[model samples]
Target: MRITGHHPLWRIAAAVLGGYAFTWGFIALGMAGAFALGMSFHDAEHLTAIIGFLIYLVLFLWAFAARSLARVWAVTAGGALVMAGAASLIQHQLT
Candidate 1:
């Protein structure tokens, strides 16, 4: 038998995976952005930590509310990839 609508397990899975991606995305982008802006390591770390927390909450809720599991995963993964790419480009320029 196949399940219909939004499965609870899938929602939970999306939340877990998306949460990690969100964190790593924030870490990469935040660090890179901070560095590009010339902020010191200590200051940038604190800034990113705070920003990550707020973003995670929003993403967590969004994951559950989204219509489909695939949509959530795609958006989450896409966002993370974009942020990571931006970080890489910024870092490259810095070096």
Candidate 2:
């Protein structure tokens, strides 16, 4: 079935929810990585990592609200790259 011209509000809601789910999933994966790396949750660095995750989450939500899938993808991908870069920077800074 061909779906056409869905309400922009519905599109926005779907996009936001999608972005939230994606962000949460990524955060969970990062937490798992931290555990693997023997990083304790009580560490100040852990808090910084969570703050970075929140920044990415906000970026994703902003992109979703813009209602352009191409822009959303670009922002999401860019955020992911930035997150990875940030991780490397954090490692260098901490070590």
Candidate 3:
């Protein structure tokens, strides 16, 4: 679980790629939730996009700093799946 002994490539991939997936899911869920709450589409998207950038930065840094690569991957990947699924459900409801 220690990040140091494992290949740095894994850490970098977790940081960049996993962070992107998590951030994308966050944006999608945030936008959908906000829109469901009656926010304008453009406003919801803009707000969520801004928040997603900050979330991605945090996730990217955490990927390197965390002691467990498995935990990092699980959180990012699992969160993405759950959030994206919620977003899809919200979108279906909206439609």
Q: Which candidate tops lDDT? A: 3
Candidate 3 residues lying further than 4 Å off, grouped into runs, are: 1-6
Global lDDT of each model?
A: 0.83, 0.56, 0.94
lDDT of 1 at 29: 89
**Candidate 2, RMSD to the unseen true structure:** 7.1
> Candidates sorted by lDDT, descending order?
3, 1, 2
TM-score for predicted model 1 compared with the true structure: 0.83
Which ranges of candidate 2 are over 4 A from the true structure? 1-5, 42-49, 64-67, 70-95
| Candidate 1 clash figure, as a count | 0
| lDDT tens digits by residue: candidate 3, 1-95 | 33355569998999999999999999999999999999999999999999999999999999989988888999999999999999999999999
Clashing pairs in 3: none
Query: Considering TM-score, which of the candidate structures 2 and 3 is the better prediction for this target?
Result: 3
